[model samples]
Target chain A: MDKKKRIVIQSIATLLQNANLKGFFTGKIYTGQSKGVCVPGLNCYSCPGAIGACPLGSLQNALSAYKFKLPYYVVGLLLFFGTLLGRLICGFLCPFGFLQDLLHRIPFPVKLKHFRLDKYLRYLKYILLVVLVIVLPICVKMTPFFCKYLCPSGTLAGILLSFRNSALFQAYGKLFTWKVIVLAVILVAGVMIARPFCKYLCPLGAIYGPLNKVSLYRMECDASKCISCGKCSAVCEMCVDPTKDANSAECIRCLQCVHECPTKALRAGIKSKPETSKPSHEGEKVPEGRMRGKD
Target chain B: MRRIGTIICFGISFLLIALGILDHQFQAVLAKAAKVCLECIGIG
Candidate 1:
């Protein structure tokens, strides 16, 4: 892992959201004009120093107001982001993803990879996206179901807000208690399981997953160069077998596989031609002149 | 066929987003942005 680059990017993202340290100490969210514009990552809108809105929160609020209006801005922003980079946002930009990456770095056994159930559990995020983020808000009429009942990001923001005003902590009821417990479990499990929330629960990741197949940015393996060494797969934290399926929904586009490939077989970029599948036999030479460069 | 389908989807999404911008939905977002979202802060 390029720990330095990851840390630098994470620091930049954290600073971008929490630029107003005074707001953090004052227990006041940045109720500025920029807050209307949603940031591409999973930072909470209610965070005391956050300067941007969360897409999930914006989506729900817009849906809740569906009786009177359309959530055009929120929907448009999400589509623009999804079509552009998909889960690449999760890999490079999300504060929650950075937190999970940091937590997983704390030297531990890292046990969840071996569980067969983990594969199936990855589908759960889609269900959460459909049910909690979409259906519940429309059905319940004005309830931000995902943010109210499930968002650990919001829960973390609540904790941050509580640091400045003890009344926020005192006001915690059953619902708040439930969210805190959920956040605690997710934080603890992050130490053992790589991106537990991202794999199993994040609606934002679920929304971006399908976009992976169609986004302009694509990852490819050069079959002619690949030696079938399994180095790319071994280094991938997202469990993507880049050789077999470089554009899999599970791929966060973290580029670890691309960086780790000793054979220089992997590449990610905008291009004109479709990617070729990895060869079935390792020794067979790939046909020439099929792959095209950028248009 | 799949590629064509994807292109069609993108076309529709871009159109809807254009319509959204024309409708000026950003005003609604700005209105919400002015106030602190109490529920999001975990305070009743």
Candidate 2:
């Protein structure tokens, strides 16, 4: 998107606060506080000032409480965002993702791709999303299983809200210790990898990924007019191999494809006919200091 | 087909939840089936 359009969307995101949701995130009780512009992403449901239920948490609750599936408001919201903005939310909206990006920029000078554990741990998020967020809630009669057990968001939120409600603090026990351990691990991992949670465990990513193929917003590759020079893939923070497939489930639709394409061959939400051109598979040299903005 | 599948799967989940809500028996059946499946896999 152009600069003016980008500014407008960002201002909307910044200005649109679900006040009730914010209050909810700030408090311990669910007052059904339903106000605020819910930024579509994997946010902490229990976050003080979180107006909407974390989609993952809601999914877990729906599974455990009713012993069946519940309404998927979270998925709908996420798809809406994915349709409208793609992974621009990661760059511009999600507070957690934003935090991770900021931490990575912390000048401590850490090498990201150098560690095997960093690469391998990405899959753990997927496993966590499936097993902790989905399966355990269904099987164990637990509400917000991932939040209760594994979420760093929960730990952060708990630290803030528990101060206001002493009863909540008093309620902390061995399970809390376990959650703390998980939080410590997650924190360490976050410091190491760019987005350990999103890469490995975010079910929201799993959902958003499939939608990228069909969403109004997308990261698209022109198969016909393309050289497979991996310039697009080289600079991608999400580690998407844009040349192999631009809209792969692994891709967050960040539009690095569009920005990095030296030939200007990539785009968002393809509607144009494929040009009758040769397929070039040689990885091209990626340019530096790239930026692409979207709503 | 995928949309239909999503709807069907979601519908079944609601049915299970509705049944479970109305009857602990259904919950028992669900929990039982799940536990048994898990145990069979040595997950317990």
**Model 1 lDDT tens row, A13-81:** 878876767877898778777887888889887888788888898888877774656677777788778
> Lowest summed-lDDT stretch of 10 residues in model 2 chain B?
B35-44
The per-prediction tally of clashing pairs is 0, 22
Error of 2 at A76 (Å): 5.2
What residue pairs clash in candidate 1, if any at all?
none
For model 1, what is the error of residue A205's alpha carbon versus the real structure, in angstroms, after optimal superposition?
Answer: 0.5
How many clashes show up in model 2?
Answer: 22
Give the DockQ (2 decimals) of all models: 0.47, 0.05
lDDT of 1 by residue, B20-43 (tens): 767776666766655666666555
Each candidate: chain B TM-score: 0.64, 0.52
- TM-score for every candidate vs. truth? 0.90, 0.68
Output the TM-score of candidate 2. Answer: 0.68
